[model samples]
Each structure stands twice: as structure tokens, then as C-alpha cells.
Target: METSATVAFVVYALLFGWRLVDAVEGSASVAVLAGGIVAGYLVADLVSGLAHWVGDRFFDETTPLVGQNFIAPFRRHHVAPREMVEHGLVELVGNTAILALPPMALAHHSLRPDSLPLLFSGGLLLSSLAGAVCTNLIHRWAHMPRPPGPARWLQGRGLILSPERHARHHRRPFDRAYCITTGWLNAPMDRLGVWKAVERWLGRAARQDPR
Candidate 1:
């Protein structure tokens, strides 16, 4: 009944914490995962912009108007750029914690109890970092415009480990590929067609803008 604020805060806190964990995991590895996340954070605007532009450009007569309605309003109004940046990290932590559950459970239950704890713990942490990094990059990329603030410093590798790309997803939600750091897997993701549309548009734009 009275769970509104409590629920919201809890959700916010989890996102904030999780992103921190994601940032940490990303730091440990510097390849695709790390780069993706960093890309998400540093150039969220570009990534999301490309994603959105692609989505629009490739949209056919039946561009799945169903889901867009729910997402559009939320993107335009509810998602606060300030809160998401501050709280996004917490959500990342929560996500990693959730990811750790299977590994953690196995570690807790298995007889002889192998290195599940170490492996899964590492996995959980890394998952957060990877997700956050990817999420930030892919997210910021999708949103079109960058989030405002001195917090933009987060995009810089020196200060924040996570990517800024995540901002775009918040600002302009879409069904194509919602994740921040993992664009490669977008095709494998559930909405293969949508992701393809986004890619097609992006390809067209690249040919034209050459930016």
C-alpha cells in the first residue's frame, strides 16, 4: 500500500549499487566488455542516437507501434536523467547481485562445494561490470542526446568505470536492443527484426554522414 517511495528508492538504490559493481568488473578486463561499457558511457549520445535514428529510418508501415506507446511516454517524462545517473549505479549492483544468485546458490548447496563461490562471485561482479559498461555504452548510444552535467565526468575513463551510453536508453526507450554494453548480441536477442532495422538505419546513416 505505502510501498511507493519505498519501492522506488529500493529500485533506485539497487541500480546505483549494481552499476558500481559493473564498473569494477569492467576495470579488470579491457577487451570488448570493458571497451563496450566505456563506449556506452563516454559516447552514449552517439550510440543511442545512431540506434534511434536507425530505428526510425528502417521502420516500415508496420513498425510495431504496440510497445512504443508504453515506452515513449516513460522515456519522455518519468526517467529523470539526474536520478538515473546517480541511481543507475545502484541498479547495476542489484543486477549483478541478482546474476550472482544461481552461482551463489550452487556454491551454497553443492556437496564437495567446488570453486563455485569464487567463480560465481567473480562472475556476478564481472556480470555487473560488463552489463553496466555495455548498458551505459549501448544505452547512451540509443538515447540520441547525452545526459547533462558535471557528471559527464563519469564518461571519462579516469573517473567512472561504467559507460555513459546508458543515458540514451533512459531518455528515449526502445525495444530494439535495450542493453547498454552488448550490441553484438542484439541480433541474438529476442527482437531480431527490430535490431536489424536499427542496424540497417545505422548503415545508411554511416554512408551519408561519415561522422
Candidate 2:
């Protein structure tokens, strides 16, 4: 896992450099790239919330790959929220790196300098990939009683998950505030009743007759 994470990091470092130089020399405007990055960050927030909700509610520790890799840890977290702080960097970032490798590779091969399509598509994917990779670190900070001064500052500014905001999820039933990266989408997602809607839909599907 550590090796895979290391390889993934190297790949991203190289790809970022390549894209940076290409965007500078190629036709894609900086404005377009910026838009793509913002969109990507938002998308990552939504994805993080969805994934967290599913892991928390839909499965158990006995379930297979997802069970062991995702659901089990979530279950453990409900009992010991601080466990995340003990997690090694490899555990925090490795699996995400594996998931990110493909999209980063695709962008590297398919995108070109100055192209709006490249900026919109490739930039969105790469930036969102970055956000996803940062999820664990942000979550750890949320759990800390007193993270570093800089981290506290960022959390206070709402640039990252704040301890007070994340505490709601740690409350009994563990249902809301699932987005841990930046915690930007939790309120909107909760207000829209998105996760409840998904649960009802899935419950209905599970009850359908197989015959």
C-alpha cells in the first residue's frame, strides 16, 4: 500500500508539472482552469459526503472489499472518533491515490495546452482528485482537540472542516455532516434531504421482488 501510494504521488507530481507547463504554453486560459478547479472542488465535496453516508449506513464489516476497506473503519470511527489521528499516512492517502491514478493518466495523455475542453475536463478531474486525497487529513484535524495553530486558523475560517461543525456527525445516530474535506456541502446536502431520499430509494429497491 505504501509503495502504491508513493508511486501515485510521483505520478501526480509529474503530471501536475506537465500540465502546468502545458497550460502556460498552450491555449487554455487561466480563467478556464480556475473555473474547472472550483467546480472540481465542489464535486469532490459532494462525492465525499455521498461516500461517507453510504459507508456509514449501507454496509457492515463482513461485507467484502468495501466492507473491510471502507465500512469497517466507518463503524470503528463511530466508537472511537480519534482513531483517525492514529492512522498512518499510507492508510490515509494510499487507496485514494490508487483511485486517482487512472484519471490523472487519462488527463496526461488526452489533454493539450490552451484547450478549453482540456481545462474543463482534465482540470476538474485533477483538482477533484486532489480534494479527495486531502479528505483524511482534513478529517483528522476535525477530530483533534487542538490541531496546530495554522490548522485551527483554517478551520476557523471555514476553509477546512472545523471541529465544532464536525462534532454534529459524531453525535448519536451519526447521520449528518458527512462531507469532511472542507465541510462546505453539508448544510446544502442536508437541507435538500439528499441522503434520506437515497436511503428510501434503496430501501424500496431492496424490497422489490426478484421473481
Candidate 3:
């Protein structure tokens, strides 16, 4: 089944249909529906963070429950626990707000119907999926080392991802690149992607002018 947020966002968008109700004929379901989406996505992320926080705080497991072996290859780059907490906190806040902003804006002037369930459910489903997909993509990129040459150009746009830009997060291990996903997710997003791109671009520059 589609996650609650994914289903919810789609349904919320379709809320334009609620106009059929005579009582809310002029209402814009966008706000109410989107708000539900925002809330749903935020809740999922909150849950995930809570899990991570609890795991880190209580389990005393140095390795994650999942991806222990996969991430092992990158052990040379294991970040400090303090860094994880700081970066993770920034991610928690930024990601939650991103989901919340769209619907919150729409709600200010929206006209929703008496039956808010459709929009509510739809919003939750769509938003939930958004967090999952976006996070997954970013995490994937962060794990991979920078690709060579023209692929270097990707670093410029790679902020949409997580792992690729994460190297700087590893190097500094204290400040910046807090979020692996988007610039909006954290200033570190822009910093990480841009720095990686420039690093690659400089490599290309040196190769072309090698004296």
C-alpha cells in the first residue's frame, strides 16, 4: 500500500474536487489538504529521528542495525559521535520544516470542506513517501565517492542527494554539510555539493594544464 503521506499528498491535490460540496463550493482545499501532507511527512521523520536518537542514546550499538557491512567500507571516515548528533539534529529540523512549509502556506487562504478525511489521509501518504525517497536518494549518493571527469559536473546539482556531499561532512566532522539532501535542508547541502563539484572541477583543471 502507498504510504500514508504519498497517498495523502495526491488526495490532497485532488481536493479541488471538494468543491462539489455546496457548503464549501468556494473553498480551496489546497491549504487544509497540504497541511495534512506536511504533518504526515513530519511525523514520519520525527519517528525516524526518535528511533535514531533512542538507538544512539540507549542501544550502545556503534554500528547501525542496518547497513553495518555496507557502511564498513567507509569506516576510515567514521564521523565523531558529536558530529552525528549535530548533523542529525540539523537534519531533523530542516527536513521537518520543508514538509511543513508548502501546506502551511496554502492553508492561510484555502477553503476546505467539512469532510477533511480525504485530504488528511492523502496528505499523509504523499508526504511520508517524499521523506523516504528524498532521504534514500541522498543517502545513496553520500556513500559513493565522486565520479570522474564530466560526471564531476554532477556535484553542482548533487545537493539533491545525500551521500555524495557527505564526504565534507566526514572531513569537518563538526560543522557544515549537516544535511545530505537539499540546500533547503541545510546550508551544508549547498556547501557540500558545491565543494565536491569544485574539487572535481579543480582536478579536471589540473589534468588539462598539467605542466
Candidate 4:
């Protein structure tokens, strides 16, 4: 499954790249593409935070569907934060690659010549998936004793999640700094009490549930 997902991810990524280049050459403005890339990064960060929050706060490792594969990893990471560093590339990115396939496929098929809007949207979707595909690797880097020089540089500049920023999430309560993609949204989201509010709502909903 991992190997297949990785191969599919590579194929879709290449297709998206080709379409993106074609769009640029045809009619898409550089500014629009740049905006889409920026928007994609922010959206990916937001998504990472929401998924991280859900993984950390809800469902046990024994629950159905997401239990063993998803929830367990998040739970284990809290106990053994450095374990992610030992994961291979396929292990790190395969699941996200699987999740990314549909949108990537759609973007590849939907992108057209001289259509700035489609180009912009395609750029946003593909870039966001690209960010998503890199999330686990980025998270692993944060836990590494010393990541690659380029990663270290990005982390230092706050262009990506850093060890220092991610450390707060592993601390007791484990309720803050959930945006593991770039850490750009962590501060604002934490300050706004977004996760806390969601937790409160979920708690109330659970209490009211008949199940």
C-alpha cells in the first residue's frame, strides 16, 4: 500500500507540475500563482492543526477506523516523540500521499489553457497537497537532534516548524501548538483558544449523545 501510494503521489505530482508550467506559459499570471502558493501553505497549516487536534483529543487506539493507524501514532508520539525520526520516507509520507490523490487527480484533469482561475485553484490545491505530503517529514525533522542544514535553516527562520515550537505540544495538557506543517498558525490559533473551544463543544456533544 505504501509503495503504491508513493508511486501514485509521484505520478500525480509530475502531472500537476506539467499542468502548472503549461498554465504559466499559456496565460496564468505569476502573481496569481504566487498567491495560490501562499494560500496553499496557509491552508495546509490550518489542516495540519485541525487534524493534529483531532488526533490528540479524540478517540482511543482501540476505536474503529482511525484507531490503530491514525490515533495510535499520535498517542504514541506523545510518549516517544523521537520515534518519528526513525521512519523511512515511504512511512513518513505514504498515508498523506493516499489522502492527497483525489484532489491531485482532479486538479490534473481540470486544469485548462488560458484559464487563470483554474490555474490559480490548481496551484493552490497541488501546493497544499505538496505541503501535506511533506508534513510528516517536517514533523520528523522537528524531533531530530539535528535535521538537514536546509531544514534547520528554515526552522530557524520560522519558515517551517521548529523543535522549540513543537516541544510545547508534547508538554503536559498537550493542547497547544498543533500546527505541525509550518507552525505559522500555532500562535494565532492558540491565542484565539480555537482548540479549547472545539474541545468544549465536543465534550458537550459527547455528553448529550445517546450512544
lDDT of each: 0.38, 0.76, 0.42, 0.82
Per-residue alpha-carbon lDDT of model 2 for 94-166, expressed as tens digits? 7777777777776677666456766676668777888887788889989888888998999999988899888
Better of 1 and 2 by TM-score: 2
Q: Which structure among the candidates has the greatest TM-score?
A: 4
Q: How would the candidate models be sorted by lDDT, starting from the highest?
A: 4, 2, 3, 1
Candidate that scores best on lDDT: 4
**Tens digits of per-residue lDDT for model 3, 179-199:** 443323345334455434544
Candidate 2: 10-residue stretch with minimal lDDT: 202-211
**After superposition, candidate 4 runs with Cα above 4 Å error:** 25-28, 204-211
Q: Sort the predicted structures by TM-score, highest score first.
A: 4, 2, 3, 1
After superposition, candidate 1 runs with Cα above 4 Å error = 1-79, 88-92, 95-105, 108-173, 187-191, 194-211
> Residue 207, candidate 1: how far off, in angstroms?
33
Off by over 4 Å in 3: 1-27, 61-114, 145-211
lDDT tens string, model 4, 121-177?
Answer: 777887789889889999999999989999999999988899999988878666789
Q: Of the candidates numbered 2 and 3, which has the greater lDDT value?
A: 2
User: Using alpha carbons, what is the TM-score of model 3?
Assistant: 0.36
